[model samples]
Target: MNTKTLVSICSPVYNGEDHIEDCIKGVLTQTYENFEYIIVDNASTDNTPSIIEKYRKKDSRIRVYRNEKTVCMDDNFNICAGYCSDNSKWIKYALADDYLFPDCVEKMVKVGEMDEQIGIVSAYRIAGRYVTSMGLPIEQNVFNGAEILKQQILLKLHVADGSPNTVMYKKSVFFEFNGFNSKYNQSDVELVFKLLDKYKFGFVHYVLTKSGRDKKGGFYYLVKHGFHILEYLDFGYKNLSNYKSISFDKDEMDYLKMYYARAIVSFLITKCAYFEWEDIKRMLGNIPEDIKKEVKKTFVRDFPKHIIKYFVSLLRRIKSYLRDKKRFEQFT
Candidate 1:
C-alpha cells in the first residue's frame, strides 16, 4: 500500500468541556504529523466548539463540523469520519475526552504501511475511571482470533480491543462496512465484532490512548449500553446461529463463564447503585431458568466474597447518604 499521507483521525464531542483541550493537544502534538484531525461536534452546549475553532485556526490540518441534529454516538462518529478528506489510508476515532502518546500514530502507521491486508490495528490502553471495567488501569494484549471466537461463544461478551481509543482501522475498510450503527448505544462493540467478522486485525503492541477524563464506557455509560445486553447477546447468537458446540474444553468453558459473570455484574451494579429493583427484575426476567442456576453456581464459585462485600458496600453507601440520625438516635 503506497500511501502518501499516513493517517486520518475523527473525534466525537458532546458536552465535553472538561477534557477537549488535552484531547486535541494529544493529536496535534503527535510525533507523527502526516495526519488529519476531524472533530465532529454533537451539538455540545459547552465551549467545545470554540476550543475546536481555536485549534482549527492554529493547525491547517484540523477540521470541525457540527452534526445537524443530535444522533447516537455511533452516527456522530461515522458522520465525523465521513468529514475527513484524507480517506487515504488508516483512520481512528479519537474520543473527545481521551489523550494519546506522541508515538501513537507513528507506530500504527508503521504497522499498516508494512501490512496492507491488516484491517484493524490496536494498542494497549490504560483503563481509567469510566475507561474500563477493571477498577484500576490495565493493558490489553491482542486476543487471538481463534481465542476471540471461543471467548465470544463462552463469555457472551465481545472484548474487541480494550478501548475504542486504542483502535485504528483502514479507511477503505471502515467505509466498506458503512461505518457504524446509528441506533444502538452499544454500537461500538457491534462495530468491532462485525469488523473482525469480515477482516483480520493486526495488534500494534504499544500503549497509545490515555484515559484523560471519564467519558464513555464509564460505569454509568456501561449500564446505559449494557441495558441492551440481551439484545446484543441475541444478535451474536443470531449471527452465529449454527454454533452447535455448546460444550467445549474445561479451560475454554471456564473462560466463557466470565462473560456471563461480567454481564451480570455490570447490569447488577447499576441497578443496585440506583436501587432500581424493577430493572433488576427485568434483567433477571430475560434469562432462562437454566442460565439462572448457572449464574447462582457461578456467584458462589467465582465471587462469593465479592457478593458479600458488595451488599455491605451498598449498605454503607446508602447509610452515608441518608441523613436519618433521628431514627438511629432513638436506638442509641
Candidate 2:
C-alpha cells in the first residue's frame, strides 16, 4: 500500500454523543490508511469531546480541535476544512451522524486519481434504507462538468448533488470556492453545483456510505416546517443564473420559471400556517423580482380553487369520522 495521496477527513460536530463514536470508528477503520482524521468540536456540552479524546489518545492520526463557542453549521464546517494539513491532496467529509464503508476512501480515491481534472468524486450512498446519488450511466466513469450541471438543472441526473457523506473533493478546488456559503442551509448542494461549473465530475457505481436521517437536524426541521421549499427556490434562483455554460432555450426557461412560481404559490396556499408572516416575506424577498411577481399573480389566480379543494377535503374527513361514530353507536 503506497499511500502517496494524503486525504484530510473532516468531521464537525455539536452534541453528537449518540453517534460520533460510530462516525469516528468508520473513519479509523478505512481500508485506505494514509489520511489525517480532523475532528472539530463545536463546543458540545455532551460526552462528544471525551469520546473524541478517547480515540485521539489511541490514534496518532486523529487531531482534535474545539471552538470556544458554537457557530453556525456552515461556518464550523469551513473552520474544520481550514484545519486540513497543507500536504493533503484531497478532502473527505464524514459528517458526525454519518458513516462510510471500509472501502469508501479507496474507491473514491481511485476515481479521483484517474484524472487531475476530476475535482469532485461521488458515489451511491445508502440514505436510510434506499440507495441514492443515482442517474449516472453505469459504464461511464467521468463526465464534463458543464454537461453534469445541465443534467442536474434539467432534473436528469442527481449524482453531482448530494450530502457531504457521498462525495470527495480536491483540496485545491474546495478552497478555490472558499468552502461552503454560510448563508444558505443547503450550502453543500450549492457548492456541488458551483464545482461542477468548472471541473470534471467522477462517479463510482457502488454504495460506499450510509447517511443518517436525523429528524432533529436542521434539514429535517426545515422540511418539517415546510420551509425547505422556499430555501430550495432561493438556492436555485441564485446559482442557476450564474452558469452561462448551461444554456437553456426560451421555452425551457419559461417553463422552469412558471414551475417555480407555481411551487411557491402552492406552498403558500397549503402550508402558510407553518411559517410566520415575517419569515415568509423574508424568504420571498430573496427570490428574484420577476419570479416574486409571478408568485403573487399565481397566488391570486389559484387561491380560490385551492381553498375550495381544501374545504372539500376537510368536509370529507368529517363525514368519514361521523360515519365511523355512527357505526360504533349501533354496535353499542
Candidate 3:
C-alpha cells in the first residue's frame, strides 16, 4: 500500500468497556494502513482505560489521550479530532460502539481523491439493512452540496445516512466550521448542513459500517445528553434562514414548518411515554407557545401513528427477548 494520503481515525470513549476493544481492533485492522488512530477517554471509571492501554502497547500508530474530567460528547469528539497530525488531510470519526469494515478508509479516500471540492464522502451503513433506502433508488455517486442540504431540510434524506460513523471528511473542512456544535443533540446533522452550505459531498454505494445502538449509557445519560424534540425543532427553526447557497420559497418554508411540527409532536409523545412530566416540561421550557400549540394539534392528528409505532417497537422487543431466552436455554 502506498499509504500516501494520511488519514486520521478518531474515536471517543466513556465507560465503553465492552465495545472499546472491538472498536479499536476495527481501526487497527483496516486494510489501509497509513492512518493514525487517536482514542480519547473521558475519564472513564471502567476497564476502558486498560483496554486502550493494551492496544496502545501493541500498535505504534495508536495514540491515546485522557480528559481530566468528563466533558460534553461533542467536546470529547472535537478533542479526538484535534489530535490529527499536521500531515493528515482526511479524518474518519468512528463512534466507540460502531464497527468499521476493513476497506472503509480505502473506499472513502478513493472517492475523496476524485475531486478537491469534495468535502465529505459517505458510505451506506447497515443497522437492519440499507436503512437509508428511503423508498427511492439512488442514481448518482456525486451530488451537489446545496441540493443535498435542500433534500435534508425538506425531510427527504434519512438522518441515519448522514451519521458521522459512515462518513469521512477533509481535515480543513472540519476545522472551517470549528468542529461539531454541542448545542444541537443532532450535532452531526447540523454539521452536515453547514458543510453542505459550501462544499460537495460524495457517496459510495457500499455498506462500510455497522451501527450499534447498545451501550448508550442508559437512562441518566438519556436525560442528560439525549436528543430532545425541541432541540431539533429549534435547530430547524434557527437554520432555515441561514443558508447562503440554497433558498426556499414561501410554500416550501411553510411545508418545512409543518414537517418539523409533525416530527416534534411524534417525539413529544415518545418522551411523555418514557420520561417524567417534569423532565419533559423542562426540555420544553422557553419554547414558544405557537410551537406548542402546533405540537398539540399535530399530536391529536398523528396519535394513531405514534400508537402504531409504539406497538411495533414493543413487539420487536418481545421477539428479541424471546429469541435471547431461547439461545440461553440452548447454551445451558
Indicate which candidate wins on lDDT.
2
Off-target runs (Cα >4 Å) in candidate 2 are: 224-227, 238-241, 273-276, 300-332
CA displacement after TM-score superposition, residue 101 of candidate 3 (Å): 0.4
Off by over 4 Å in 1: 1-3, 129-149, 152-159, 212-219, 224-232, 235-238, 242-275, 288-332
Lowest-sum lDDT 10-residue window in model 1 = 132-141
TM-scores of the models, in the order given: 0.74, 0.87, 0.82
lDDT by candidate, in order shown? 0.68, 0.86, 0.79
Q: Give the Å error, residue 149, model 3.
A: 0.7
- Of 1 and 2, the candidate ahead on lDDT is 2
By lDDT, the better pick of 2 and 3 is: 2
Ranking by lDDT: 2, 3, 1
**Ranking of all candidate structures by their TM-score, best first:** 2, 3, 1
Query: Tens digit of lDDT per residue, candidate 3, span 116-169?
Result: 898888877876444552422467667688887787777777532346887898
* Candidate 2 lDDT by residue in tens digits, 229-256: 6656665554567876677888766766
**Highest TM-score, which number?**
2
